[model samples]
Each structure stands twice: as structure tokens, then as C-alpha cells.
Target: MMPKKAENCISCAVKLTGTGFTRFPCPDCGEVIGRCAKCRGQSNPYKCPKCGFIGP
Candidate 1:
């Protein structure tokens, strides 16, 4: 089963709030990942907590 969406940004560990935050499944593990708008805009890399899959 797919993992639930994270409440904090995976890249920066910031609480996910307001608009522009995003949640999507990890390509390797189907685990949900969360990203804040700042991190996404900066192209910061994030690692999946479940499978260690990293992405830009």
C-alpha cells in the first residue's frame, strides 16, 4: 500500500502548511513524500524516509 502523506517537508523538515506545499509518491517505494514550496523552488533534494530514495 502507498504510504500516507507526510506532515513536514522531507527536504527541510519544515511543517507543511499554507499553499504550494506538495505531496507525491516516491518512485522507488510508493511512499508519500512532502515538499514545501521553498524547497521545491530551490530544487533541494529529498530522501524518502521509507526507502532512502533520493530525488531532486
Candidate 2:
């Protein structure tokens, strides 16, 4: 099954709001991943909570 979309930034656990936050599907598990502007700008690595898939 497709995983639910993440509500907060995966790397920082910050609430996603305003501009620059992104939501995309995990490459490995099709789970939605969330990234805040700061983390995305820094290229922080995020793990898919459902499948253990990590990406930067």
C-alpha cells in the first residue's frame, strides 16, 4: 500500500508551512516524504519512516 503523506519535515520534524517545503514520494517505498526549506537547502538526509530508505 502507498504510505501516507508526511505532515512534518522528515529531517527536522518541523511543521510544514508557508513556502519552500516539499512533499514527494520516497524512491524506494512510494511513501510520501516531507522536506522543509532549510533542510532541503542544506541537503540533509532523510529516512523513509515506513521503509528505512534514506536519501539526501
Candidate 3:
């Protein structure tokens, strides 16, 4: 089996690339989340899919 790659940016819905996405755990549930470089740089708000908690 292969490791799953990020499919899209959680904030902007942009297609993700190997070097353009950042992966981190959701603060509430510890679920992995993916954010694109552009959004991260711009401080775009992201919601946790597992808990619906929103944050920058």
C-alpha cells in the first residue's frame, strides 16, 4: 500500500503538490489536515473536518 497524499488545500481547495502543501494535526481531534502553501502564507482560516472547529 502507498501512503496517502494530500488531495486539496482545506482552505482554498487548490490542488496540492509534494512541496506545496503542509500537513498538521487538527487541534481538537488530532486528525491530519492539509493546507496549501498559499493559504498558510496568507493565514487563511481552516476548519477541522473531524470536529468542525475553525481556526487560522
Candidate 4:
């Protein structure tokens, strides 16, 4: 069993199951960002507020 952690989708800010999200390192910084499956499936663009980097 796994805990249901909450995480905000980087592309849409929707609350998603942490286990259902994807974590990747920011290209500009080493910080990690979380993207939900819905956003990733739709190729939604996301902007990293910390580094101002935008991408799908």
C-alpha cells in the first residue's frame, strides 16, 4: 500500500496523486518539478516560476 500524497500539476495546478505524477529536474536549475498524467498526455505547456522556463 502507498500513501496518497497530494501534488500540484505543474502545467495546470490541479491536485493529483503524488504517485501518479512525474518528477523531473529543471533544465535551468536542479530543482524537481511534478507533472500530472493528464497534463503530460495532453502535451500541456508548463512554466517553471522559479526559472521562467516554459515547455510541454
lDDT of each: 0.90, 0.90, 0.80, 0.71
Candidate 4: lDDT over CA atoms?
0.71
C-alpha positional error of residue 49 in candidate 4 after TM-score superposition, expressed in Å: 1.5
Q: Higher lDDT: candidate 1 or 3?
A: 1
State residue 38's C-alpha deviation in candidate 4, in Å. Answer: 0.5
Model 4 agreement with the true structure over 18-38: per-residue lDDT tens digits: 555787767986556778988
Order of quality (TM-score) = 2, 1, 3, 4
- Predicted candidate 2 versus true structure: per-residue lDDT over 1-56, tens digit per residue: 53366789999999999999999998997888999999999999999989899898
Best by TM-score: 2
Backbone collisions counted per model = 0, 0, 0, 0
TM-score, one value per model: 0.88, 0.90, 0.77, 0.72
Q: List CA RMSD, all candidates.
A: 2.8, 2.5, 3.7, 6.2
Worst 10 residues of 2 by lDDT: 1-10
TM-score of 4: 0.72
- Candidate 2: the clashing residue pairs are none
- What tens digits encode model 1's per-residue C-alpha lDDT throughout 8-39? 89988899999999999899988889999999
Which regions of candidate 4 are displaced past 4 Å?
Answer: 1-6
lDDT tens digits, residues 1-45, model 3?
Answer: 322544778898787786867988878977677899999999899
